[model samples]
Target: MYVIYLRKSRKDSDLEALGIDVLKRHEETLLELARARSLPIGAIYREVVSGDSIDARPEMVRLLSEVESGIWEGVLVMEVERLARGDTIDQGRVQRAFFYSNTLIVTPGKTYNPAIENDNEYFEFSLFMSRREYATIKRRMQAGRIRSVKDGYYVGNIAPYGWRRVKADDCKHFTLVPDEKENPVLKLMYDFMGNKKYGFQKTCSALTGMGIVSRSGKPFNPATVKTIISNPVNIGMLRWNYRKSQKAIVNGKIATSRPKADDYILAKGKHPGCISEDLYYRANSVNSSMTAPVKRSCRIQNPFAGIVRCSCCGRVMVRKKMSAKQPRDYLICQYAGCATVAIELDELENAVLEWIRNYIADYKVNNFESADDSEQESLRSILVNLEKEKETTLKQRGSLFDLLEQGIYTKEIFFERSTALEDKIKDFDKKIESVNADIVRLDLSKKNRSTFVPKCQELLNAWDTFDAADKNTALKNVIERIDFTKTEKNARGQRHSSFSIDVFPRISR
Candidate 1:
């Protein structure tokens, strides 16, 4: 049976702009080709994914997996280029899948049988040309977007909260227009910040009090308020590349992210702004002058800053101050959907200290130590030998140059000898690195076993004398994390309530 695959080509931007269904058209053409050839169609894989890598395209990945599993006799497409236009690795993967499975690639103009050498070579050549064409198309698209931005038009997919996009007079592009109901609300937000001297939380309160919400139809958050107040678009300036695209291989997979850029284009836009320049700048200046409450005068307050986790949800619980009527600090879960409950700050600290006290008592009873010095010494010995071998290899590599200069070795011979020695040196370095890591892990184990007890004892003895910041540092050195849970309840007047604290010490619990 034959399967049909359809993916929109980058070359079909003209068709897309003209509101033509390129994928549907390609499918119809392939179905007609199947009928002409008297082929039986088992399945159709229509790919709408707009990405370069096979890893990014789900339908292509599924198709490749099925083809590699030897399920179909042939695959039909408009062209081979539609199967793979990604990087060389993806192209080779697509080629090998069909070649090994003996699957036929049936296109309208030609049919490629991967078993034949001539057909295989022709298939490779076609893929090479397709790759070149794809690269050109990508460059042209980027240039078009840059030109659109420079022409003072709105090119982003979605407009900001207080604006709407309308087709320009030429009907080729879009321009921003102020929204009737939202524009006045945006202006009012600026007025509250600029003239009325309100902070983010107070502004959020003011908006919610007036029954005005965000674009998500929810109460305004401080981060969203900051975005609105800081954007240059409110003052009729179009900004581009505020966050630049960056890609890196993380854990052997390509990861892409957009980070804030220092330099960006802020140009005069074609549409009028909802707020005046005076109000925009004034609000920004006022917002900038105030310090955020979370900074806490550059001092640490939570001793379990990075060491506390909610057992139910695994989220880091934060310490928050209650209202003026209550006037007490409480450790609370961040989200309302979480199953965990809040506890008073003082009570939580007491429970943690008690857990540590019990841990120290248990450690004293065990009183054991790790004797890893001999293994560490053995690893160091191996490292020393590896370094000596690497130095000898480097010296050998250097002598090849002399051999070539003296006409004793031909250029090819010298290159071969030099490459061999370079590879040997690289191997030695890799061994040295592995041995070094082993030695370091041994040392850390010894330190955790021999040194952690005394430190834990000192922390308990001097707990009262240390300040909050010092105590936090001391606690971090001994504790990895504390998993807290409070699924049971007790009387309100009870001091030691029905709660559990599972301490994960760096050494032992």
Candidate 2:
């Protein structure tokens, strides 16, 4: 009994471009060899993908597992090297698989019998040579990539946001072109972070408030906001080997990871920059200097943790618990050199309720529409367009691999196109999701309109009985933030003082 194992090699890519079916050719040759010797072919394993290790390649793993069972008399391949060219351990594993099974390694050139000492030694030597060749090819590719980066070409698999990857008209290399729609948003992201001195969270929130969304049509997140503002690519720069790939054995399986590295090649790119270098540097400085988020506590302390801010310094007002002598909780601005005076929490809460009542009056006067049939109809129209976009993106994605195989796109270009298409498809899906959510929210808003005033009144009535966390959550559901201004602190500790409170409601009214 015998079996055939097949996998495409690196050289096979070029052959594929030449319209040669390398696998089929190998298969025919091997089949001819089998017929000449009158050997019976029991099974055939064809690997449709490429991977660096056995675990990464499914068919190869199954072949080795079966070979280890010693069920076959021989394992036929186009070349002995095709069986294993991963690493020394992998080659040794392949060597041992045949040696222990006493199976012959069959190729078109010659047959290697594991039982013979000379044949086994020769087979191992062939596998080692194949590994060396593979390593050399990879090293060359890496060197080429680095050279491309140094020459101001964009060799990355995906283009940075606000930019599109395009092959340079005058040269063989690829470069970045600004995306009209995304370019403005990318610039605004920088403006928010650098010029306005907003943190990632605030920048994302501001963008969402302005109805700016990612290609996926979802609200921008902190991580995405940071990536966009901090990326030197927006300033016409390229980063090479920023995070180098690290390979290790994890739980008896090969795993690859790329960890953040401080040292990397940062060169000026050929692409036109979207933002100024000053903006780029400033945003990064703010990003690094910002404090980390506080972890959630077991018990809630402040009802207005996020919703209250110091009007002077623009920092979130912190809850300061008084000692036994003071007997009060004050929301204080913690910024150094800030002139903002702290106000007692009791006084602030009462002011917030008064403001809520005023807001209810204003809402009624304005006669704002909570749910509109026309708005839902508009959302439905947007949803249909998003679905169409997703369908087109998916279709483009389907042909990307074929283009790569046909040599229509280089490996780098293929990756960029694939990533862009995938991102577009994901964005469309999210946009569709967001539209659906809007429709549902409109339906909920109809029910919610009558409940709003009662909800606020109930909270005001039950303020003392409610838990700190419960109060905070209730306030956050309606209020965006409460700006507090107090320039002069009272010489005498007064619960009631000349302090001002400005409540920013989440609702439009």
Candidate 3:
């Protein structure tokens, strides 16, 4: 009995040559060939796979197993190349298997009867041809992909939802443009991401509630949604040299690593986008800022996410839930080897409140009547110097022009001297405008400072009524990074809370 076999390569050109149901057709051809040779065909086995690697082919293994069972005395294929490319190693394995099973391998052009010595060389030649064909097909497909990319065609499948792929004028190349109707989603997504209050899940829920389906009208997936939010292509750029692949080097050469942000190929937008450049930038800033938070299994909001840091280990201290059964949570140091014990959330809250109260009182004590006296003086000095320079430069320019008009100097000489003085005057005018703006700011600052103190005192008085989250926000608004360091006792000493705080008034968290 004879078994029919069929195999097709997944290469691009083969995709065109073999048609869609190439494997099925090849199996049919094998059956017909078996019938023509008056062979009794038992089973038809078909294989559809990429021919890039031959380490694991399930159909190939099944064929060998069937031969070993002695149910089929021979196998018939449409062509010899269908077995495999003429690779010596692969052919050797196939030859050995057939020899052990005493099975005959027949193709349209030639037959491999292990019983005949001369048929062995012909079988080997068939394997070599298949391998050569595979290499040729692969090379051509790769070259086409390179040419397409160079011509700015978007080659990947489906093209990430919000984008629509359209072929170029030539009909051979493709490009991506933002889908007009779906582009509004980008702006809405950015708005949600820019604020820390709305997280990934919340954003998705909000969008779903707004009757905003995905580009395909399906429920929004968190993974796919997150990818769309973070993709650089939204900012009118394509990524090249993005994915890392394993490759061998002949010499002592190092693998070049491309920087993700810098590796994107910037392209002009071919379609209208809903989000502006500024908003896109802000969204990216928000996305990149909190990478560590999203990876955590537990979702406890960290009060001092980017602010608090351990002095010894230099890791951010995160809030940890101590007991799920009780309302007992604590702030724990994030450092892996840190010996610091977790401070109870309630205790830490009280400490922060007390510290803030003390901080406000201390700030009030240092707040003299002329709180910004030095800044005011510096502003006045700068304004006066600028006014004097402007006056001098204008007077010099006026005198030079007068000399030029009076015919006291040649046109060339006059232009040379006048150009030099006019340049200086322009420079001075810019400095004057800058100084005038500073003077106005100083005036505004002086006026605001008087009202600011009372407003700050009012907020502090009401701080006791504020929630933990609100209090954290208020404190961060006033202070930048607080250095929590161990306070050591000196010769005449007093011990502090083991940690000292460094506060900045205007800097951000």
Candidate 4:
């Protein structure tokens, strides 16, 4: 018995445009060929997915498995390319599976018996030709896509949240037009995060509460909100080739890493921007300031959720409520083997507040002697030095251009020197900004601290009124980590514990 294996080419856009009927015709043609050859077709394995790799197509994998078991005497296909159009490794696997099973590969034009050396040679040669053709077609398609992107047309299928995909005038390329229904929601999201200082989770909750669903008709998720906010496409910028390399099939799916800043292809898009560049960056900066694990939605407003670590096992301490009727929250070590005893959440909060108050008292006493004017003068001197270095780099870059024009430097050398100078200028620019920020902070410190202590005290006093996200942010800004360990019980059986808190003051930028 013979199995008829059929596959539609992934790169065949013409066949896809003609619709499913064209693929059906391919099946009919293969059936006709089998009947003419007088072969008993046991089962027909038809795959609509692109036959790029053996792992990518499930039907193909099943076919190979049955063929290797010696269940079928031969395999019938339209062509050898239908069996494999992948790299040498996949092609070799297909060839060896047939050869070891002593199966015959029957195509329309000829019959290839893998047991025969000559036929096996012809089959291998056909696979090689198919691989070469696949490479050629892949290159042409990639070149077309690059050209399409450079021409300011949207090359991807799915448009971003605020945009709708539309066919261009030429009917060959696509463009993005603003989706009327979603644009208003997108604008509101940006305003909430950038202008209102709302976190991603809070903003997502607000949108979902307002009955704003995503394209899938599901409630907005934090990941979806983050993707929309951080996307440069909203600012009328197209970013392509952001992956460092081509995707590799890992666990039967495409996986790739982000490319470096220099490798990205960024261009001004033809579509109108939904948010200003300033708003985009500001929202992204706020999102970036958050700790990694804090991006999710938290049900309980525990400021010390991720910050509190188990002293014994170094695992994060989780907040567990004892009962629904008389709820008493306690911070317990998440690890099963950790011997750390549970501490009441209220007791922990009180300890943290006391530490903050003591820190403020110490700051007020020690900071009085250090004059802010002297610090400002020092920062100003550093800023002046950075400005001079920036000027020198700019002059060096200007000289390189002149040297290139005067034939004093080759194109390669000029580019090398220019890149070095450009990098130097960027470094100087960052240092200058840092110094200026320090100067501003120094000037503000003198006046702000007079009211800072009172404001902090008020924040701590009303901490319960703040939401979970706000409390988390405030704790992260103030405290680095709080170590807790239980002490031995006294003769009266009274247990006592020691708390060590590491405090980091919030720096204004």
Q: Pick the candidate with the highest TM-score.
A: 1
Q: Give the total clashing residue pairs for model 3.
A: 6
- Over 4 Å off in model 3, which ranges? 10-21, 49-51, 54-58, 68-71, 85-96, 115-117, 180-183, 194-198, 211-222, 244-277, 287-509
| Pairs that collide, model 4 | none
Q: Taking the tens digit of each residue's C-alpha lDDT, what string does model 1 give over 1-509?
A: 99999998867888988999999899999999999999999999989778888888898899899999999999999999888888888899999999999999999999999999999999998888998898998789778877787788888889887899999887988889988988888888898999998877678778888988887877786667888888888888889889888988899887998867888777778888778889888888774312233454677766666677899988687766556765667776554335577787788888888877787687667544423666677788888888988888888888888999999999999888888888888888889889989987877777776777788788889988987678889989988888999865557666566778888888742
Report lDDT (Cα) of residue 5, candidate 2: 88
Total backbone collisions, model 1: 0
Candidate 3 clashes between residue pairs 3 or more apart in a chain or in different chains: 85-127, 85-130, 85-131, 86-127, 86-128, 86-131
lDDT measured at residue 134 in model 1 versus the true structure, 0 to 100: 88
Q: How good is model 3 by TM-score?
A: 0.47
> lDDT by residue for model 2 over 31-136, one digit each (tens)?
8889999999999899998887777789988988888999898988988889888898899888999899898988888999999999999999999999999999
Mark the 10 consecutive residues where model 4 has the least summed lDDT.
287-296
Model 3 lDDT, full chain set:
0.64
- Score residue 340 of candidate 2 by CA lDDT: 88
- Candidate 2 residue 394 C-alpha distance from true site, Å: 58
lDDT of 1 at 489: 59
Candidates 2 and 3 compared: the better one by TM-score is: 2
Give every collision pair in model 2: 216-427
- Rank by TM-score, highest first: 1, 4, 2, 3
Clashing pairs in 1: none
